[model samples]
Target: MNKKTGTAREAPFDLAAEFEGARLAARLFGGESAGSYLVAGRLIRFDRLPVGDLGLLTVGFRITDRPREKWTRRFNQFKYGQPSAVRAATRTLCAAFGMFRLDGDPRVVVVSSVPSGQNVVRNDTPASKLASALAGSRGWEWLPHHVTKDRHPSLTGIASAADRDATVDGKYLAAPIGGEPGLVIVVDDFCTRGATFTDIARAIRESNPGWEIQPVSLAKTERAAYWKGELTNAHIPDYLDAAWRGDPAVASPFF
Candidate 1:
């Protein structure tokens, strides 16, 4: 500790936060191998990271009034600036990542883009907050990029499936890539048709082709909630085969 220079120190990892995350994961997936739900979440595969791809891992299901409903409620609070939910939420997203890190790479970079009027560094959105919390704990580092100048229409209701591709394309323009390449994870609160992941991944991949880009989400819609009421968690297990809440999107990514 440099007393004269007044260097700041990162907060120690909170055991309470870890407990909360484990509790949430257990409640959502189950007590036995809740991390089993963490799959190779490739509803659509962007690329591979290592021989063991980090893949597209996700946890839990999130559609209004469906499985993991309670989680969605907290997620909404997390979205709307609930400061308390950040750490817990982050750990849940990465509840069992140690399972992978033990064998795969431990270095992780979680990135996200925001709506207009927010820059990456100053952004305090839920995803950003979670990323910051994770960075403080593990070797994860938060790269505040993905600067979108325009606020596009949110893909919800009918727009989620109908105009998702049109809405998300070309919106996530990230800054020039610099620094060493680690596992780059582009995160979202929820995913449906993979359009959001595709668009965001497309932008990041273009900027840094060699860097492995992986998409992680807290929840993946079983189907377009607005278009149809049917949502299934079945497709998730097939792709990840070793994942949680069925993170892999077995269906075709494009509509």
Candidate 2:
């Protein structure tokens, strides 16, 4: 268990067992199978990260109305220029990094999050600030102003797969600026459909195909929340429904 966040550590054995069980259940009951697969050649973790994918991952689940609501509110405060929220997020990230065991002296690079809209400047998002803080704490390199949202294909209100795909395709990624490639960690406060990470991965792969891009968010929505509120055999789905209550089309699928 992670002492700082009071969340259980993602053990390799447990993950493997869970995956095996999921596969077995799928074979027996005709449900969605489980395993680390790729969307645009990037491994996606709807529920949990695979072993060795990334250490000291999420702080908590971001399911709507869950205990993570407080964290989400704090993150929004930081986004809207709250100093205390920034400090809190920084401290939490630092603590999480301490818990993860790094191998050798891996060259860590933090990706700057894209702005919300075309008029907004890059490196101004709250997630970027969190990444900057984490990079500064470990003396790791921080790449800012590297990516930006080219269009305002607002994925906020829409809940259809077609709309989500269109929004994701609208995102633009600038070529990496740093010298050599290393482990690229993209930080975000919340992940609903993972379209942001997917777009970022596609951009990175286009430029530096060999670099490993790991998407680390503070919280992620539960897979079961995407379905009809029934979680008897909950498993992460390829496309998730926008389960947030604030969403105009909460019942719509995110991606």
Candidate 3:
């Protein structure tokens, strides 16, 4: 979970022990909160709030100024694009999700955002591809983006002048199609404003509103800002608050 660099250096602690603790936290809190805390502590930067031995954890990236380039580069390597740092992180995330067993040979349909025009090598090896590959062991069906090529707002709408149009155009590609509704999970490399996930979720909802679409990713870009000591407690609401305030320069494809 070393952040100075993108390396997911395994901590000396036992993963099973950590998983048990996280499970306990979720049971008491009603969802994946405990697992979220455990993940934030080891992989991403975040703090926890104690409730006896158990506690609520909030991500730490909301208040910090860590650079995204570091993460992007590291993630790039993890995708079979470089040194494979992403594989290590993916394993950690999967373990945290208790997603070890597959119900059947999963027919995986992976939907990825092009982010740039045409199919390039980098996009081919993007985070979605990496996750698809990793999950392939369990019979995943990687479905590519369903929409036409276009630039759409990230769930968080704030876009810098430096943000490239190619990046935006490639996003529409990730939208889930109406016909393929059996997808159990949707993976985005990162989520900040959550616009992308929301769009994909909306598309899924429109096609088959009942489908379960759990958004999973390696890092929450916002987590780098607020992570602090072990005793700090922030809620999911905080992240959503920021999402609501995000800009509209980045338009939603659904809009």
- Per TM-score, the best of the predicted structures is 2
- Clashing residue pairs in all predictions, respectively, total 11, 0, 34
Task: For residues 52-91, write the lDDT of model 2, one tens digit per residue.
Answer: 2232244444445443355455546554677666655555
Of candidates 2 and 1, the better by TM-score: 2
TM-score, per-candidate, Cα-based: 0.58, 0.62, 0.46
User: Best lDDT goes to which candidate?
Assistant: 2
Clashing pairs in 2: none
Please give the lDDT score at residue 184 for candidate 2.
81
lDDT score for candidate 3 against the true structure? 0.42
Give the least accurate 10-residue stretch of model 1, judged by summed lDDT: 44-53
Candidates arranged by lDDT, highest first = 2, 1, 3
Error of 2 at 248 (Å): 41
Candidate 2's C-alpha runs over 4 A off are 1-56, 66-82, 119-124, 222-255
| Residue-wise C-alpha lDDT for candidate 1, range 1-255, written one tens digit per residue | 668879653233332243355456668766453323322322322122211223345554555555355556655655566655554456555433333332245456767756534434355676665555545555666776644435666556444354666766677776656766655777766655566666666677777666766666666554335533444445433223332233343221210
True-structure RMSD for candidate 3:
13.7
Error of 2 at 137 (Å): 1.3
The reply for model 3, stretches above 4 Å from the true place, is 1-109, 116-123, 145-149, 152-181, 223-225, 228-255
